[model samples]
Target: MKLSILDQSPIPYGKTAEESLSASIELAKMADTLGYKRYWIAEHHDMSGLACPAPDIMLSRIGAETENIRIGAGAVLLLHYRPYNIAERYNMLAVLYPDRVDLGIGRAPGGSAEATIALSGNFLENVSKMPETLDELLSFFEGNFPKDHMYSAINPSPVPKVSPEPWLLGTSEKSGILAAEKGIPYAFGHFMSEQDGPEIVKRYHANTKSGKSLVAVSVICAETTKEAEELALSSQLWKIQQAKGEGKKGVPTVEEARAYNFSDEKKNDKIIAGNSGVVKQELEVLQEKYQTDEFMIVTITHSFEARRKSYELIAKAFGL
Candidate 1:
């Protein structure tokens, strides 16, 4: 099985954005040396908790810092930027990093409504143009557009010897169908929504030509199951804040979570947490259910060191 990291650069309760970003770079280097497959950064705008608003810039810095593991945007909110610009930036990254670039795209706004407007001037218009934007992005990679197409007259450049591998990141059947139609890799954001992951993976494999499937999930690993559960309270509290639209700044500490008094049902609904053995068991079950060999972990905790150790434990568990 292959393991990857999808870092949102979550700003812990006391850490600054600079510290969070530095942690991301350090984590990328760690993953590279630990024999992991990929280190993908997320793009989230106007979220004080998420330090990475520009994944392209982070990818460039991470690419410079890592040697082997692929560096990429976990999901660049494609609707916010021009297709040609997106194409050029990623292709330029490919030029800098060669075959070690993965370009994952998503249609989500990646921010609040007002921030979305600030990003693209018109969120709805950009959302409506997503399909065409995606097509134009792919055309830049293919270096050709249909003769009658308006983009046929222009080509996005410094096309690398190998284009960055494109993956559609989504949580539903629509995303599966689109990725299948496009014939690229597909990633299911199991951590972002309550959608049925096994079904999504099943449908994606059933429809895709390449049969590539990736699941991004929330995982917290510790030395013991009890310790893991305790650490996970913070994530639960963070989710509660997000649900209430109050968690836009930073991830809360474990103490904050304990004080929040989240419902037991809500705490049990998500978060795969335990010791290495238990985490491995849960992941193995997921692998069997999805019939895939890859899993991308998204871990957010109060302490940077704990977050780093979580990945380390998971990597050790998986023998990655």
Candidate 2:
């Protein structure tokens, strides 16, 4: 099985945004050396806990620091930006990193309602125009606009020898259908969605000519299952606080998480916490169900060391 990383660059309670971003670069380098398939950074706006707002910028720095692993935006929140702008930015990264760049597009707002408006007015309208926008974006990458098309006269600058691989990232069957129709790779956000992932992925494979798919999962691994669960408390509490519209600060410490009076209903089933062996076994089960060999693992913890160790343990378990 192939393992990859989806880094949100979470800012722990006491850590600064700078620290969280630096940790992302370090993690990317580590993943490169550990033989992971890719290192993807997420884009989030006006989210205090998540540091990254422009994954394209982070990818440039990470590309300079890493050697072989593919670097990309886990999802660039395509609703906010123009197709030409995104194409130029990632195309530049492809020029710099050659075949090691990926452009994972997503339609979610990726921020608060106010932030969404701040980034791009009429987000709902943009969502409705996604199909046409995606077609234009791919046209920019492939330089395949129709002969009489208005955009045929222009192209994204500094196109690389190999255009960055494009993958549609989403949590629903709608996204799967879009990706299949576009004939690009699909990445199912299993970590965030409550939808039927296996069915979505199966449909994507059956319809897509590309036949490429992966599942991005939330995971936390440690030397022991107890330690992993303890480390996960911070993320669990953060999600609870977020749903209640109170999570403006960075991720809370384990001590703070333990002290919080979480109701029995305030549980996050998305996080998979366990030792290396247990995580591997569960991932294997997911791989079989999803019928994909690649899994993008996203792990966030209060301590940077714990987050790093989680990836290391998983890598060792998979012998990557």
Candidate 3:
């Protein structure tokens, strides 16, 4: 199995955004040394817990700090900006980093309802235009704009020797279909949706005529199964709050999660948390079910140390 990481650059309680960002860079370096295949950063706007609202900037810093590990956006909210703009920015990064860049674009608003409106000025209209925007972005990369298209007369400059590898990110079957139709790589957001994993992967494989498929999973690994369970609770309350549309910016402590009232189903869904051996076993089951060898793991923990340890333990378990 090829294990990769999806870092949110999450701010733990009482930590500054700077600290969270610093931790992300440090983690990227660690992942590079640990033999992980890729390290993708997430973009979340107007969220206190996540510091990486601008993955392009973060990618530059991460790429500068780490060697050998591939770095890119987990998903840049495609609805917020012009496709030409995204294409140019990442193309610039590709010039600097070459084959190390990956651009994963998604249509979802990466923020609250209010922030979504703030981002694009017109949410629904911008979302409705995502397909066209994706086409424009790809045209810039492939230099294949349709005849008479406005951009056919123009070129996004500073084009790298190797263009960025673009992947469509989605949590539903619709995303898979669009990706397959576009003939681009598809990354299933398994971490975001528990019920849709098996079906989404199946559909993506069946429909895709080209490009590989990847799944992102939420994982928490620790020294012992009991300890891992305790640490994993940090996300239970956070998940509950998110469902209530009251999710906080930073992670809740295990103590806070223990104090909150939550059903077992919500707490366990889409999460693979346990000791190294247990995590490995659970991941195997998921891999078998998804029929994919590539997995991008997202870990949410209260402490930076714990988060790093989680990845470290998992990497050791996978022998990556």
Candidate 1 on 1-320: residue-level lDDT in tens? 99999999999888899999999899999999999899999999888789989999999999998899998998999988888999989999999999999999999998888999888888888878877788889988897887888888776678789999999999988888889888889999887777788887888788866769889989999999998888998888887788878887689988887777555436645689999999999999988888888999999898988988999999998887
Highest-scoring model, TM-score: 2
Kindly report which residue stretches of model 1 are placed more than 4 angstroms away from their true locations once superposed: 148-150
| Model 3 accuracy (lDDT, Cα) | 0.87
Per residue, candidate 3 scores C-alpha lDDT tens digits across 51-122 of 988999999988898889988899998999988889889999999997999999988888888999888888
For lDDT, candidate 1 versus 3, the one ahead is 1
Best by lDDT: 2
Better of 1 and 2 by lDDT: 2
Pick the winner on TM-score between candidates 1 and 2. Answer: 2
Lowest summed lDDT across 10 adjacent residues in model 1 is found at: 261-270
| lDDT rank order | 2, 1, 3
Clashing pairs in 1: 49-249
Give per-residue CA lDDT, model 2, range 1-320, as digits (tens): 99999999999988899999999999999999999999999999988899999999999999999889999998999989999999999999999999999999999999989999999999999999999999989999999998898889987988899999999999999999999999999999999999999999999999966569989999999999999998899999999888888778889899998898877646788889999999999999898899999999999899999999999999999899
